[model samples]
Target: MKKQHFLVKQMPPEEIELEKKRAELSILEDDLALKELDLTTLQVVLEDLRRRYLRIVGVKLAQLDGIEAQIAEIIARLDPKNEEVKKEADRRRTQAQESADATGSIAAEEYEAEPFKPSEDLKQLYRDLAKKVHPDLAPDEQARERRHRFMQEVNQAYSERNEDRLRSLLNEWENRPDSVSGEGTGAELIRIIRQIARVHNRIEAISQEVENLKESELYKLKMRVDETQDESRNLLVEMAAEIDGQIEAAIARLKNISQRVEKTERSRTKQRDSKR
Candidate 1:
């Protein structure tokens, strides 16, 4: 019975150690969950900002350009040698040019920084880091610490959307970290790297599709059509400005609409945030 007692005593210590390890793992899992949720929320905010900026700037600029084009077309149809027509065309042209410049400036201001990094380059960086610091190969505490540092670097680079920093970090990891060999570990690292690469590739493809849609012939034609309409409307205003009453009435109406739209946009934004 003395040998049986020794075995039972040995089992209790192992069980206690197992429970401690499980508790540590639970804490780690909770931390990772919180980090993931924060990351997802940030991504959503970024995407929404991009969409809002594009809609406001792109659509409005297109409308302004269309207005200018229409004014120009109307002016061209008027006989150039006639003093009234000549003066009208010159005035309308100046107004159209001013409107175009304003729209262009707004477009420039609304531009957002492009996506994190091109898929291929980002994937390459991920692969190089995975080779050096993959957790499976880092069996000891010191090695694990190094792996954690490398992973932090990877996440930082991604969050900042800094391709240059990511490339430098990957290069540093490849040069400084201990190398691993053997089929199983290397294969596992490759698999994880490939998964990251696939995600980057998909993001790049989606971005490209969006850009292509924006630049399509149909889109260009619609812009041109709108520009023509705006120009025509502007030329009519220039022509009618010769009649004082009409010019005053039109200016007043435009001012009213502009004020209303501005107020509505502000109210809508406030409502959106409140809902969130």
Candidate 2:
């Protein structure tokens, strides 16, 4: 019995440790893959929601702008002393035109343009980082692709002048803290470890980004749209109805004001005839 047990070849302590590490690494690889998929899904859904929300909100704002401008015009034509109303009409017209230009339609001005000018220091930093991380300098094709992506990030951060992002990228390249893995082929394990680290970073970044997106105005608009969605209910439809009501009321007021003005003019003509 003892000889048979000896012949069974039980794993030694060193081999057991290696086996444990390998299992842990495999689990890490699986986790990294799932996180990547989640990241992609979150990004796509948030972006699509943002676009639809903005489109609906923009169209409604445009309608409001048109109605306001018309009301201002009516008041100006009805009362000669209403110079402020005339100015307001001109301003609203200019704003509406700008909104149209930006959104490729009426009333979407939520997106604002920011100025970007690369400082000399930023440019120099980018050049130094780019040279270091250049794909052509990588030892293997896989590392080369990884470096290529890293360089793209460097270029983008430089273009956007995001100093902090550039610094973080540099830090990551210098330190592969997560590269410690179970015993394996040295180069292969290093590649897997580095990939795992990057995927973890991406998962965190994407998670935070998606969370922030949830707090945005566009997200609220999307929520509103969903809440109002039914066979006979819609947010844009309700907004249009309200604005149409305001427009009708404004037109009625303008007609009444015009009648009063005409009546006053006729009264003055009668007075002039009596004086003659």
Candidate 2, superposed: residue stretches over 4 Å from native: 1-43, 46-57, 70-90, 102-184, 230-232, 247-276
TM-score of 2: 0.49
* Candidate 2 residue-wise lDDT, 1-276, digit = tens: 355444577876656655565566556545543443344334444455544434655555565566666566656766767788788878977877665554564233353232133566665565556545655334456667887788777756765568788788877877853222345455444554554455456557757876887787766766776677644567765765676676677667657766876787899899999999
Top-TM-score candidate index: 2
Q: Which residue window of length 10 is worst by lDDT in model 1?
A: 233-242
Alpha carbon lDDT of each predicted model: 0.51, 0.60
Off by over 4 Å in 1: 1-117, 177-276
Cα-based TM-score, every candidate = 0.27, 0.49
228, model 2: CA deviation in Å? 3.7
lDDT at position 19, candidate 2: 58
Worst 10 residues of 2 by lDDT: 106-115
Model 1: how far residue 209 lies from native, Å: 26
- Give the C-alpha lDDT of model 1: 0.51
The Cα error of candidate 1 at residue 113, in Å, is 4.4
